[model samples]
Target: MADNATSNRKRCSLNAFISHAANTTDVVPEFPARNGPQRLVAAATKQPKRRQKVILEPGHSALDWARLKSSGKDLRGVPQLGRYTLTEIKEHRTENDAWTALNGKVYNMTSYVKFHPGGVKDVMRIAGRDGTKLFMLTHSWVNFEFMLDACLVGFLVPE
Candidate 1:
């Protein structure tokens, strides 16, 4: 009965060692002989692939501005919308006809007023006025030139 108790204790100790090793390592240890020791072999692990960063040049214009340039008589001799006075811009103040000046450029934002992410009130607050300061203060990172290309009315006439 003493030999049986010793054999049971040895088996329990071997099981505890194998459990600890399997939990700590990636591979499971194999025991060829039931009464023998445990041998652990590590399993191969695949490392994650790293991604390379792409750098773009400064002042990169994604769109071709040359294509949008007016050439024919469709412009009614205006030749690229010319320039607009503050008084002319102020004429479109209501929600039905909203216009805004930003960075010396005029933009007819009537259609975009309701669709503004910041809300119509925010857009209306600067209607028919120089919104360059307010625009930069709130959303300096926004690419207005590319996003509002179709909404552009003209450049502001120099004072």
Candidate 2:
């Protein structure tokens, strides 16, 4: 009976030590944003637009394929996970939430609307933020004219 009491106390002490260690190391901490009081207050007050989900089907659309050879049009060079129209983007603006980091920085390359060599559809497969890296890596013929056009459009967008 005396040994049992000693064993219970030892067990409780061991449990306490384990709980303390686990709380310190097992948790990853998140940092709060550091901003000036005015900025923080403004940010707190600002109401973000309630976004809705935008769904793009897994495969390329008929419109996407058609735009491939439509030459002499400007298809902003953007990342292509799937094809989406500007109208569709507005309707389902929430999809932009999934791509916040890529937004403003990336453009969708709609080869169908623009003139492209190696076929516009082929380029559409790789239309994200890393256009220069992708272009140089994939050996796609560089078109400064199209790139410049895309840059002009990208610059005009409000951040």
Candidate 3:
């Protein structure tokens, strides 16, 4: 009887100790007091650091031909011969002489028509017309300016 009671007491004590330890093990410590240099260091470490400002070197402007020509200054001696009106652009609508107007620029796409990823028919459909909307709709992500840079015949003059 006495031994049974002692065993029960030991079991109860062990259970109580285990419960207390479980509770303590799961608890997170409170943050350190907020007035010291430790707190400042903690706060600083928690925040994201400001990134250094990137100083990019001046590079080529893709579509800003006016700026490029003006900056060169000596471009005045280079006689510009290929400015075309809409009527003139319309004259070159065949596959052999395919010209396309996109974003106020005229591109002679005769050679490019054969190599078009979408098909020559797509290029032919927009020949000699302002295909800006269709071009953006079909290939808004394509860098047409860069791709057609070499094919650029001239700027489109107003009707």
Candidate 4:
């Protein structure tokens, strides 16, 4: 009879110890806290920030462009918005003063060429012409509207 009682006590003690250990995991961490899963998902989903092969000059980074946009510089060049014929737009082709149309909106792309991810050559190719097709083909993801809002010259009207 005594042996039976001792056996039962040992079994009960083992179960109690297991239960305590299981419950203690909630209070005492088994492993360190980490966002491992979140970081993996983000790394998989996030697109590359820069697609350019050429390195940008100092003070001409993407952040610099954002700062330049807000700096109150007259990026538009013109006093007010007005329709521009393709002929007139062609005249402003130089890197010093470039104008191009994308999605029917004309933007003064002079200052932006330096900030371009694809370097000046890529942006210069679109100068003084309708770059909607080329721009879309190269970097369709680019949000030109938002990027060039401050540099907006006007709409591109038929000549």
Candidate 5:
């Protein structure tokens, strides 16, 4: 349902193939290198060996989470979005009803438990607490705002 101009990917070929000819001819990159072509391969030594992620269950992938978020489901456990105090958020620390404050915004993380790559227990470590510091210390590169936008309950309020 997206326009060709707005789409990030280019549609060059009507036929999909795996041969070298198909890749070299059909796959036309949007940005061509100024200094001829560059190799797509990367050095093995440059690749990272490990990360904090664990194997996610079927249908719990990051892409699955993105789809679920766009499904119009109310992931937030609360009846409506409202400023929540620490005590109020603390009451929702259970696995079935978890909440956390990050960067002053409160997000209902109950729906995100299975989608969390760090495992359920790791996410529960900050349940009912402000996890900005811990989240920064662990995975600062993650954009929580965009990831958990659909699960946004409200803003964190002073207790």
Candidate 6:
């Protein structure tokens, strides 16, 4: 009878130890509340952060472009003249070199670089650039004053 009691006590102790170890070491609870709201704040109250415009460098590598091309994605859309791939734009420089825009426009800002509102240096970095597969020139010229905005106007120049 004593032997039986001792064996039963040992079994109960082993089971208790296993349960305690599981509760202590386990990271996730066995069951979590299913119907709780995922997000606490209302969506409308959150203001989305605006994307900063990229100040392009001449001969800058188009990492995003290369990735898309490697993935077998279609490289459609208009060109961005001042914007270019690092490899493609590296060939052009000096007075005669130029980069083409999406709508077939051309901007030779090398000489006019100084005249840029953002200063000539910024324009030169992106001018004579190439390999830009996508650009925005769809808006009406009257909607945004060209002369007032140099970045916008640089792409607006006709070929």
lDDT of each: 0.68, 0.43, 0.71, 0.91, 0.84, 0.42
Candidate 3's displacement at residue 41, Å, is 59
Residue 38 C-alpha lDDT in model 4: 62
Return the lDDT, model 6, position 88: 45
Off by over 4 Å in 4: 1-52
> Candidate 2 vs candidate 5: which has greater TM-score?
5
TM-score of 4: 0.67
TM-score of 1: 0.49
TM-scores of all predicted structures: 0.49, 0.25, 0.49, 0.67, 0.66, 0.25
lDDT of 1 at 82: 55
For every candidate, C-alpha RMSD to the true structure in Å: 16.9, 16.5, 18.0, 8.8, 18.2, 17.2
Best by TM-score: 4
lDDT (Cα, tens digit) per residue for candidate 2, span 6-39? 9999999999999998777564534443565766
Model 4: per-residue lDDT, tens digit, 82-101? 89999999998999999999
lDDT of 1 at 79: 42
lDDT of 2: 0.43
Model 3, C-alpha of 135: deviation from truth (Å): 0.6
Q: What is the Cα root-mean-square deviation between model 4 and the actual structure?
A: 8.8
Write one digit per residue (lDDT tens) for candidate 1, span 36-66: 4432222234556664433333322233222
> With candidate 3 superimposed using the best TM-score fit, by how many Å does residue 106's alpha carbon deviate from the native?
0.6
Better of 4 and 5 by lDDT: 4
Model 1: pairs clashing at backbone N, Cα or C within 3 Å: none
Stretches off by above 4 angstroms in model 2 are 1-108, 111-114, 139-141, 145-151, 155-159
| Model 6: per-residue Cα lDDT over 1-159, one tens digit each | 999999999999999999999789667643323433433334336687674455544433345423433554322222342534434434555444534333433334333333333343444555545423322322234222222222221333322
Best by lDDT: 4
lDDT string, candidate 3, 79-155, tens digits: 55477788988888888888878898888777566566555676688887777889998789988887776667788
Candidate 5 regions with alpha-carbon error over 4 angstroms: 1-53
Residue pairs with colliding backbones in model 5 are: none
